[model samples]
Target chain A: MSQPSDIIQVSNPTQTSTKSALKGGYNPSLGPIQLPTSYQAQLASTASSKRNIYDHSLSRRAPEVNLSSLSYIFNVMIQYSQKNSKGIQELEGKLNTLGYSIGPKVLELITLREGKNAKREIKLVEILQFIHTQVWRTLFGRVADELEKSSEADDEYMITDKQPLMSEFISVPKDMGQLNVNAFVAGIIEGILDVCYFQASVSAHTVETPGCPNRTVFFIKFDRDVIERENLRFHK
Target chain B: MSKSLKTTGEDLWKNKADKVNSELFTLTYGSIVAQLVRDYKQDYTQVNLQLEKMGYDIGIRIIEEFLAKSQVGRCQSFKETSEILSKIAFKYFLNITPRVENFSTDGKQFSLILDENPLAEFVELPDDEKANKQLWYSNVLVGVLRGALEMVQLDVEVAFVGDVLRGDDATEIRLKLIKILKDEIPAGED
Candidate 1:
């Protein structure tokens, strides 16, 4: 198999070990998909690389691209996902799956860009902050607008973006009830959370404030066990 | 005569499509293509086919957007459809107005020479034999044309004739009109 030259070469043993653990931890039964062995190796090698290493190297600059191409492709991806989907929920689920695949790689890349030899984030709030700032900036070119906690549910947290890139070009048909394409963004958040061992369910809701048309609120609800574990970690 | 009208039409649509974030769009597309290549184990042909299929899906829906934005009417013939495609549709989305030439004697086939492919703005193919022979970097255009034309009741075939990215002198996509689909009337209407 031919290798893409743009792939970041990673030699960090700790990162590779974590990636292998992530791979081993993946439930194969969940989907009948097996990445090609070569591709898997490429991913492994890619994951092992120090995060954000590519961004620093002035010699081999990462490709800079136009948002129009992405929007067009994503628009098609949403439409394609809609074909097999039974309902809005199913559609969102499919988009989530798509976003989930991108999360681990994105997390690693963003973290690498933040600093040298960055240790894995074990704290819940730290990880959330990483997602709110680094991940958001890397993907959307800006930090998310607000990160807040829910008063009613102790485990619930909210991340708000005034205008998300995913839904910038999308104009959902009126009949397609409450189809927040940002569900894909939520899926990415969920993927990052899952990889970090903080099990959470992330869902996107359109909380329109008068001026901002595409205002989206991603509600992240952690599993009970995660909250319990967090308390234990905090106490120690 | 119609050439100047085509230029004006292109300008009108270009203004509407300018809102898109060109950098993000380019990056996202590049990443997706890269991911597809990885997924297929560098099997360029499979990647090309997959990209075409994706383009087809995008084309069908995008046509609706095209019609809405351009407010263009139905083409009187296949020739006019080709004119609309190169002049309006390409300009509307990519800000590219490909030069149309090499028409078949029957006027059912034509070639589009893409002088500036925005999709391959910064793309450089890996130094490999398989990539040069097999990869059609912008194969998606074939599917987009095929799918969009099909929706307009023109059963057309589109294929990559050449690609500068793959070492060809010029990038071109050839399209052939198969047949015009008749409007289907419901059972009682006939």
Candidate 2:
């Protein structure tokens, strides 16, 4: 049902090149004097630290943090971003950017853990389901409440979570108006989708109802290029 | 007394603490560091300073939860404070209690050595020399300690002396009390 064959060639080279580029020279694009973008260098600097993240088993440490601790750190992050932001959208943008960085890393590691069953997804619907079930479960401890496609537009889809974990402890001041912190989660979805060539713009929206005040729906709109490829491959 | 504290910490972790998978916590912290790296644009010092400041903000709020959960009484001395931190605070929250070690002659200073850091899991610093030498991947912990201690009226200085992640002999944090805030209640209690 999915063409896992050809995409491997495309994603394979950069995957290897990524780690080896560490110890390579700084990118000229970042201005001459800038400290080398540390994250790229951070990806695979060996020997500097006696222990790497790999030396320890993924399941070794207790895989849990108290909710209170998470809430405290998350709140602090929001406050820090808010102080630096121009307005609510910018604040949400920063959180989205912050969550975006975690997206790819989580996807890769989780895929690795999925082992032999994991296959590269080439179909739009398959990748969306993978995200709806696997990605959501791993990140938030449960499958999202629902995943539904838009009736109006073929390229638009929505994944709804009744009580999104990220914004549970957060109460946006009434004046801010409709800023869903789950934009961070949306950034995560976009991060995963972009890295895998699904090429979607994901945004978090507050769709509060009397029954579910914390309801958030992540809107995923595929890029023209991605939709074109899907039409060429599947529709034809 | 310390044994009781350990049991209390264990119970909080086992039952009272509402838990989430540490994977999200670890990755989120790592990404925050990466975002800080971009925001500061290769200025590792600013990234580190900002991380510590962020941690401090967390520490202030986190203390209320730590205190309310454990029923820990006012520490009789800085030595006792260090023990509770390693045994109880770290245990129930991050799930690793750094070994408290190398006490200064005055008893005002001490170091904590971490065997496993949950935050830095799967994290490797950039291959660049300056980034490796200058960056403290987990300086937020230092800020967290300072902020949390300050909330309890313990004015303190905390920094990463060494990190195993950096290929140091051990991952250690040095904490020194400047003085107890003598005036009245904690700063944020209003």
Candidate 3:
């Protein structure tokens, strides 16, 4: 990895330091003039107010964006991470961390916009249904193919997608052993669940099916405490 | 006639592709930009360069996808190339066809005025004076154009000359065709 200073040097041929720029003291011949605390505070407040004013009229709050651009950006992200990574799992971890950062923000925004009159989900099944229908539809343009509880384990649940959107354009090499890059999506799911006070572990696995190359099954296992509480709440 | 022509063009695109939910796309782009801001320490120029670099990498591969999906052959002329780019490539991928205008007399330079930029769908430049002046919010488009054209044997310089997010009159990108690269034959094949 290149050092921050090295990157800055390469990026800016003129060698302008951002710190100096932020301080409004970008000059080589003279020292920076110090501004008093009161003056600086006033400037900061004015800046924020100006931003609010600018944002007030222009830039619609619509969340829609072109998917092709998003896919290209995601491809770049995957390629960059792959360059730095040692193994498939580490790359998955990096992607998960990336998705985790986004999950909470998306969850909050979607939940707020979902229904004007509906309440926040309290039941386990209600939350899962929300994830299955509303969240999935909002994100992928379709509901997940199936949501099933594990017959063998009460704590385990699965959300299946016949063709996961994230991996639609991705083709894993044969040499890389069992790389499900959909772990990034899994991390997003985990992040949403965690934000809603559901402690869970989610992992994406490739499930081969006839004529479907990108079929993914996301297995979610809730924490023991969550299951116990659910049992008590629902009287299961 | 113009209305019918426009609807036909849109219908052709609508029939050709599946539409994914745009919220996911918007959030993903927001995350990418936010990550770049963190990585570059809010140095807008560095952020622009890094985005362009990433776009360049994506453009090379995406061009292959474009060629496979669309029935577009090698452009006979630069005029044809720009027409296909604005009318076909942009329409197919973004569902918005930018207008190509302000062509130089030599036909080697032009500006693409994007009335609807999906990348800047929710973008607003910070009110800070330095950032407002320095940030090219959609610099990636320039890199994408450059990389994709280079692969098709056109050496070009592409750049964002104006941005609406920065309080410009409109979003515009300028492109100057440097030269057309000749195909190199392999040593043994020739």
- Interface root-mean-square deviation, each candidate: 8.7, 3.2, 4.3
TM-score of chain A of 2: 0.78
By DockQ, the candidates rank as: 2, 3, 1
The deviation in Å at residue A39 for candidate 1 is: 28
lDDT of 2 by residue, A41-128 (tens): 5544544445545456654434778766676667777887788998989998998888888889879877878778778999999999
TM-score winner, 2 or 3: 2
Better of 1 and 2 by DockQ: 2
Model 3 alpha-carbon drift over 4 Å, by segment: A1-70, A152-154, B1-11, B73-77, B125-131, B186-188
Q: Number of clashing residue pairs in every model?
A: 17, 7, 0
User: Residue-wise lDDT of candidate 1 within A1-236, one digit each (tens)?
Assistant: 25432132233435544433223222333433344465567666755442321233522324433344467688777866787789999999877777776677567655565567566989888889989987787677789999999999879999999998888888888898588999888988998899999999999999899999889999999999999998997967
Ranking by TM-score: 2, 3, 1
lDDT-wise, the better of 2 and 3 is 2
Candidate number of the best DockQ? 2
lDDT of each: 0.75, 0.83, 0.75
Q: Kindly report the fnat of each predicted structure, to 2 decimals.
A: 0.17, 0.75, 0.45
Cα lDDT tens digits for candidate 3, A1-236: 44433432323422433333233332343345344455456446645433322244322345333456667877887876787689988888777777777788778767666557546777778888888887788788789999999999989999999998887878889997588888878888888898888889888889999998889998999999999998998886
Greater-DockQ candidate between 1 and 3: 3
Error of 3 at B163 (Å): 2.3
Largest TM-score belongs to which candidate?
2
